[model samples]
Target: MTTGDAVRNRLGLGRLLPLGVATDGAWLTEEAAVLVLRTAVQRLPAVTLGRVRVSLADPAEAAAPTVPPPPSALPPGALRIEADFTAPADRPLPTVASELRELLWSTATHGLDLVIEETDLGVSGLSDAPAGPAGHPREKDMTAARPPGGRPAQPQGPAALAASAAPGVAHLASTLGDPVHLASDHIRVEVATAAGHRPLAVVGAVRESVRGALGNDGRPVVVLVTAVGTAEQPAEG
Candidate 1:
């Protein structure tokens, strides 16, 4: 299905708001945060935002809210906001790709640089058994000639099985083996400035864009963003 249809089918957000922006040391109410996350995921089928939990790093500086309010209950003024869009663990990866495409389009409109880090979609483990006893019962003579295992004598170890099984095993290994459970499609965006950027607004825009792109079959998309200059630096070698 198209992006819009997918978002509508998967998530049911009616009216979306414009982009929301926030900065460090800001105070965003819980309700507003959820709204942003909900809207974004609704649009991006590949993205599935789960339960959101907000906390104040410094209770003394900024006290925590006893009961989090809905998106509408967000208090005026900004504080550093960290919004996490938790993806569905069970959904397939292709669906996520469609949603991410939409998110990128939206962020582009606002002159933001969007980057996606895809999770590794690889097979972790595998087990296979030889085809159970190939011939029918009447083939007693052939069976008798075979080993006690009642199956063809397949070779064991790399030297014996390399020529026969290498190609299949290589293909399977490349496709399914990933040690790190990285997201197949991880997305990140960087807005030039946090001035006009509201967390809720950016997320909402992303959501709407994804929904518009992926329609009914939109997959779960995961997105994260930061200001242009605030990105964390890697450790020095």
Candidate 2:
């Protein structure tokens, strides 16, 4: 198989739903695609993403025909994405928007290998600086304790659930500041280690800690410990 096929196979790409009958390849789910793009945009300097939406430009056009077309006949630009965000007010509005547009375009076309017909970016507001990607309040602490007489809110989605569980796992593993990447089915954490610490022991501790913390959430969790003694790093795509 070719390199692309190999990569797709490794990623379980065959399971994804196809964009249309014409395209032989499948496309990532709208949620996953949005997450990928949102993460990329959130990382851009001075940009704070507020809301994101991803969908087809023409739902009717994307609807599959009775007879599936051949792979060679697929049309391009099948997907459309919309994002609302704030950027530094000091930067020229057009310049900032253009940069943001280019970043989104490159990430979709190159990183995700997905064709996007359009990226509609709206400058909803301006922020002085970029917001922390890990600044989700739920991830800050996972204790059952809450303000007296106040009930804890339920986690309504995969992302929120993962964020809620991350802090407890981090605390138990003694890597309270490490990065956590959460998906619907899995959670990958980076655990820290020291010169005298046992590498296997640390990994085992982290696994047990997060597993216990998560406590039968129905999602299979995967906890990964970073290489021993590596400096803390941000989550990467």
Candidate 3:
């Protein structure tokens, strides 16, 4: 059956009499339920059912601006964009991390190499336990806690990672903290760059390329420019 029909049938609202049920303020008919489902489904964009990817790259030196420039003076390559944070996992912690890994793999732009590095989870969640053996009660109840299973639970086929990641991909894009536009399923990042083959210029080019590839509409997109390098490095002037 069609999706709408399926929804209607499931709700038991397919084609009964509306008025019969409504004498005392009758209930909706099966047909009305089907219609409602159809309308609701139709309202969602087609892109919502499929995966969309956005790419990001570090900004080139010329693109890194110490001071803001006039809109007219801005070059096209100043925006470094990445589609990292598309969605946040509804589940907490380890599950979220696992979901993030899947999302990164699934939503990565085709032809780009992407990998998830093991991040330092830090001591925040750690706990002290009684110094004891395997079955000791003092052992923090590890039974209730577990890390997200490794890559195996990822979406499962060749692009399983990407597929699993698709649900939460928007979260990755949010980290960029810049204005972005989404059209259809594509995302666009706006940026400015400078002339010449300097480090800043190269960075800007990278930024622009990512912005172009990751452009999306109807979804959140992240545009990150390499505002500044590591703390030890001097600020661009």
Candidate 4:
């Protein structure tokens, strides 16, 4: 019998989903993806977002990911956000849907820097409150979060430390033992990131840091993002 973790990993419902492409990619957990999108949608007047999710837009695509995602983690490819929401009572449904579609698109693409191909919203109910002016999502702060500087690390102790010390890394999320997995051919690092930082870039930086610590070996380095912390205040630009 398959364990729950295996099922969750395969489905990747609440796990990390691809933020960019499979070859050079990063990930944002589905939970965090939903929170970011839902927060953006909540700004829309009279709209109540619920059950937001992110997933591969084309599930049939056969692009196997290079980075091995954690158990209960997402695979690779272009992603989409699917949401259930409460429609404003006074507005025409079609107009409201169109407005929402654009908001989600902009929020996912511009705000979160996600490779979002589609924004699909379904009306679960109608809000009884009167409609008001539409609200836009808060723009993500693009200011760089500097990585911790120090002497170059070596071997496992420093490799893990270097990766953990990398920018946007909140913590290491390895399931058991060390977060740095040294296989016969490659290395894998799992991390939880801070919100507001771009996921793709963060992962790339992490891979670089880890690789550098490992003597810049020819072997490929895989970085998997397991979680993303929520931004406390929306730093609208």
> Residue 186 deviation, candidate 4, in Å?
2.8
Best by TM-score: 4
TM-score of 2: 0.43
Error of 1 at 217 (Å): 57
Local distance difference test scores for all models: 0.28, 0.45, 0.25, 0.66
List the lowest-lDDT window of 10 residues for candidate 2. 142-151
Instruction: Tell me the lDDT of model 3 at 165.
Output: 36
The digit string of per-residue lDDT tens for model 3 on 1-237 reads: 665445434533342211111111111122222222122222211101112122122224223323222121222221111222222223344553354344333321111111212212211232132222222222222222221111122122222222223321211111112223334543323221111112233333433444444442223322222111111212222
Ranking by lDDT: 4, 2, 1, 3
Clashing pairs in 2: none
Per-prediction TM-score to the true structure, in the order listed: 0.21, 0.43, 0.16, 0.74
Identify the candidate with maximal lDDT: 4
- Ranking of predictions according to TM-score: 4, 2, 1, 3
Ranking 2 against 4 by lDDT, winner: 4
Global Cα RMSD, each model: 25.3, 15.7, 23.8, 6.9
User: Model 3 Cα displacement at 83 (Å)?
Assistant: 34
